[model samples]
Target: MSAAVERARAMIGVPFRLHGRSRAGLDCVGLAALALGREAPGDYGLRSGDVARAEGWLRAAGLRPVAQGRPGDLALARPGPLQLHLMIGTGAGFVHAHAGLGRVVEMPGVSPWPILGWWAVE
Candidate 1:
């Protein structure tokens, strides 16, 4: 498996904290950043309505838009109105810090939310 996917999976069960950025806790963005070995953004909200900003962040981390997602790719998903969530693909499923679940988790099969885009590390 890809190193990014392995990193994300290794983070499973970490507590979820809004705007968190470390092993002590993590938000979706934080989890993505850690798995991809990029610096996490310090300022961000629980929900984001700006699609361009999210894409920009991915690009800044050396990721590019992909037509299809694969293991280690980042998945941008919309779980609710004005809410953008990020997850790491694991080929079989996805790994992410779930706010409602209060921790990072591995979700098998199809995503529970609608995926807006896919970003692959360069």
Candidate 2:
């Protein structure tokens, strides 16, 4: 598998923790930033609950929207009209920190959200 996919998959089962950005625990943004590596900014965590704000933050951090994506790309979606979530593409799937499950996990299908877009770390 791609290195990004490997890394993201490796993080599976990590407990979810709001505002967390490390192995101890992580939220969706933390998983995305961790999987994206140094291309992500130092303060990449977001708890704003605003899709527009989260998208803006990713843009400000040097990520750019892409027509399509591959493993290692970033994905954003609106789980709720006002709530944005982040995930890392894993080639055939995606990996993310899920609040409901209270951990990171890999999902092997299209997400339930209305995808806002995909972004490349750049």
Candidate 3:
């Protein structure tokens, strides 16, 4: 497993807080940034702005889209073109902050959410 995925696994059970970005609490994007060790753009709520922000960071990291996610890969969940959520791949599953669950967790599958795309971190 990648160091990034190990880092992300360390975050399981962290409380979910919208727009938050700390061990105390974090949103999905915050979790991604934590996992990937990247500085994500400022917080935005339910908009294409979030997607753009994530894309910018991923591009800056030189991440490339992949058909299948590997351990520590980034999985973007998009219910629409605009709204996006980020998760860290664990190979067996994924880890992400869930607002509804009010915590970060490791799910059993490639993704618990619909994948818009999977990006492999170089």
Candidate 4:
């Protein structure tokens, strides 16, 4: 597996918490920051802004935007460094933290949600 995928998978079972980003507890955005080792902006809320804003922030971070997510792109779907949806791309799936599931989980297939964009981490 790719390093990003492996790192994200290692976070499986971590508890979900709003604005959380640690191994003990992590929200979606937090999970992405931890896996990518980058500081995400605070205004990045999951439901706060449109996908364009989210994509703009990630682009400002020097993360290359890809037309499609590959096996190691970092995924984001909210605002704030700790309060958004975060995941790691794997060719066939993605690893992310889910509030409903109460832990990080590997989801097979590209996310059906409208993704803002993907950050190449590997």
The TM-scores, one per candidate, come to: 0.94, 0.86, 0.83, 0.80
The lDDT values for all models are 0.90, 0.79, 0.80, 0.72
lDDT of 2 by residue, 1-122 (tens): 66767778889999999877889998887777777774444554344456666677888877899988788888887787557788888777789999999999999888887777899877
Residue 24 in candidate 2 has what lDDT?
A: 98
| Pairwise lDDT winner, candidates 1 and 4 | 1
Better of 2 and 3 by lDDT: 3
Candidate 2 at 112: error in angstroms? 1.3
Tens-place lDDT digits, model 3, residues 1-122? 89999989999999999877899898887888788887765744545637666666677767878888878988888755667788888878888888778999988865545787888776
Cα TM-score of candidate 2: 0.86
56, model 4: CA deviation in Å?
2.4
Model 1 spans > 4 angstroms off = none
Best by TM-score: 1
**Between prediction 3 and prediction 4, which has the larger TM-score?**
3
- TM-score rank order: 1, 2, 3, 4
**Looking at model 1, which ten-residue stretch has the lowest summed lDDT?**
40-49
Q: Which segments of candidate 2 are over 4 A away from where they belong?
A: 39-49
Position 23, candidate 2: lDDT = 92
Ranking by lDDT: 1, 3, 2, 4
lDDT string for model 1 (30-73, tens) is: 99999998887666543756788878777878899999999999
